[model samples]
Target: MDIEQLIALIDGFKQFPQIKRETTLFDIGSRGHFENPMTEVLSFFCNTTEVHGMNDLVISSIVSLIRQNAIYESLQYAQAHGKPQREVTTKNNKRIDLLLNSDEWVIAIESKVNHQQINPFDEYEAYVDSLIRTKKAVNKDNDLTDETEKQAVFVILSPDGKVDNVHLHPRWCGISFQQLVNEIKKRLQQHFFDAPFNKWYLVLKDFLLHLENLVNDEEQNSAQEEFVLTHLGEISQAWNLLKNTLQSVQQKAHTKLEQHPELNGILRSQKSSWFGLPTTILYSKDEMTEAVLFATGVPSVDIADDDPRNAGKHIFIQIHIQTDDEELELESIHESLANKAVNHWYSGGSKCFRWPVNELSIEGITKEFVSTFEAINNLSPLSLNK
Candidate 1:
C-alpha cells in the first residue's frame, strides 16, 4: 500500500533475475559475427530478396501501423494519395528507408536504434523535391498544385519510439517497436487458422517478441511487469504515497552528497563547480589508512597530467575510505570507467582506484567527499606536481 512496500516488492522480484540466453538469430549472431542486432534485423526486414517470405508483409504492417498512429486528417490525406513505393531515391543520394509515391502524395520512413546525431529532414525534403521534379518531367499537365496541403508523411521508426524532429516537421510521426509488434499481431490474427502462413507467422512472432524485449529492456514474460500490470488497481490505491516517498528518499540522498561541507570548501578553493559523481573515482595511496580519491571527469574532455600548461590546479581529487565490502564494490564498478581514467591519466592514474560508496549514509558519503579535498591539498597550488 505504501511506496516503501512497492519498492520492497520490486527489489525482491529483482533477486530472481531474468535469464537472457541467446535466443534470436540476431542475438546469437551478435556474439560471434555481427555487432548490432538492430541494424541486422532492419536490413533483413528491408531486403525482399532474403530467404524470409514475409518482407512485404512486414513493410505493409509497419506502414499501416504508422497510418493508424498519425493524425486522422493526415491519415485520410495519405490514404487518398498515391501508391506505396518500397524505397525511393532522393536528390541527396540517400535511399528513403520506405516510401509511398503518387503524383501528389509521398510517405517516407527512416529507421534507427541507439543512434541520435542524424537529422534526416533535410535529406527527406530533398527527396520530396526530386519526386516533384520527376512528376513534372513525366507529365507536362500534372495537376499536382496543392503544395500548401499535407502531401508528404515522414515517419521515424525506432525501438524507443523517440521522434526528435516532429516539432520541426509537422508531417513527421513516430512508430515504436511495441507498436510494430502490436500491428504484426493484429495482421496475424486476421488470417484463418488453417492458413498457409502458419510457419511464417511463428517466425514473425518470434522476431516481433525479440524486438519488443529489445525496446523494453526486459524478457518476453517479465515477471515484474506482469505482476504490476495485473495488480495495477491494487497498486494504484497507494500510488501517490509510493511515488512521493521514493522521490523524497532519492532527493535527500543527492542533496546530502551535494551539500557536504568538506566537498563545498574544496570545490570553492579549487575554483571548480561540483559536477555530480564521476563514473569512476581513482585514488593515490596515502601513508595514512584512507586512500586519496580523485573524480576523474570524462577523460576525453578533461586535461591530464602531461599537459605543458598545467596552471591553476583545477584538478578534481578526493580522499575516501574503503567501503564495507571493497572487493564486491570494486567488481560492480564499470570496466570502461577504469580503462578511460587510466588511459587519460597516463601512468600515475593507476594504483589505488576505489568506488566511492555503497551505503546511503551521510558519514560514508562525506568521507568519500572529503577524500577529494585531501587529494587537492596534496597537489602543488598552481600545478598538478606531486
Candidate 2:
C-alpha cells in the first residue's frame, strides 16, 4: 500500500458536472468590498442609532446569545437612544469587536475566525475597567462597583466558540457563528411589520443568508458521508494504503527539509503532526509573518480532477501568508497571487497560496515546493522587476 495505490483507488470517483448560474449584485459587491463579510454585517447589527425598531431586535438577540438574562431584562427598560458601538478601542489600545452600552448593562465581544485568542481575557477585562471608570466619573457617590452593580458580559464569538480554557474568566462565555445565525433566523420569522425598517430587515436577512452559506452545509456533508459508507470496503482499502503513503511522504520530506537551504534546521517533531493525520510544515529562515510552506497528504479530489494534471492524490504544497497587523489586509495580497501566479490558486477561507502537485516523483515534488518557498521568501513590495 502506497500513494500510487491510493491514487488508483480514488480515481474511481468521477468529478461532478459543473452547473452554470448567474451571479447576483450582492455577490459582486461582496467580492470586492466585503473582505471580512461577517465583520461588516456585525457592524450593521450593532448600529442601533442608524435604523429605528431594528435595533431593538438586534440588541435583544445579542443579549440572549450572551446568556445575560438580567441584562436582557434591563435592556427592556432602557431608552431607544442606547446604541451599540463597533470596534471600540480601549485605553490599553485593545479593540473590542462589538461594544453594546446601556444605562443598566454593557456587552463586549471578541470575534475570531479559525484561530483562538492569544490573550483571551485581557481586552475584555480592560473594557470592564473602562466601564467602571465611566460610571464613577458620571457620579462621585455612585456605588456601581461595591453595590447595585450593572451587568457586564464578555463574549468570544467564533466559528466553533472554542477558546483557551486557561485564560478564561468566570464572566467569559462562548457563542458559535451557527448559534448567532439561528438567533437571527428566529427573529426574522417573527411578525414585525415596521414599515420604516423594511430596508434594514432585507439587508440583515441577506447577511443571514450569506452566513448560512458559510456555516450550514449539513446536507452536503451527509451526502458525502453516505457516499463513503456505501463504498466502505473500497475506502477501507484506500485508507490502509494512505497510511503507508503518509509515512513514506513524511520520511522523504523530513530528509529533504533538513538539507534544503531556505527550510533547513527544522526538527522532525516540529515539522510533523499526528492528531488529524501526519502532515508536515515547511518554512523559510524568516518566520516573522507566520508564512509557511505546508506539505500535507490530500486524500480526495472532487472538481479538481477534471484536468489530466490533477488526476492523482499526493502531497499538497500550500504557501500560506498570515499576519496579525490590523492595518495590513491580506485580501489584496491573496487577490494578486490568485490572478498572477503561474499555477491555479484559490483564496477564500484564509490567506494562503497553493497549486496542484503535478510532479509524480516525491523527490521532484519536494524540490519544486522548496524553490517556490524560496521565491516567496525573497519577494519584496519595492521590487520593480517583479
> In angstroms, what RMSD does candidate 1 have relative to the true structure?
15.0
**Candidate no. 1 TM-score:** 0.42
Using lDDT as the measure, which candidate wins? 2
| Candidate with the greatest TM-score versus the true structure | 2
Residue-by-residue lDDT tens digits, candidate 2, 213-310: 54434334555677788778878887666565556655665565455444446532234553346565654445532223333445444324644544
What is the alpha-carbon lDDT for the whole of candidate 2?
A: 0.54
Tens digits of lDDT, candidate 1, 1-386 = 75687777667656766555546654554442221345345546544445655534555565576667645234532222222343455555566665543334555667665567275677787667555555432123223445444355677877667677656766667888788888777766655443555465565667777776666553334557787787676667655553443334334333443454444422222122233322223223342222322332343233444443332323233333333433332223333233222212112223334232333343444443443333333531121111
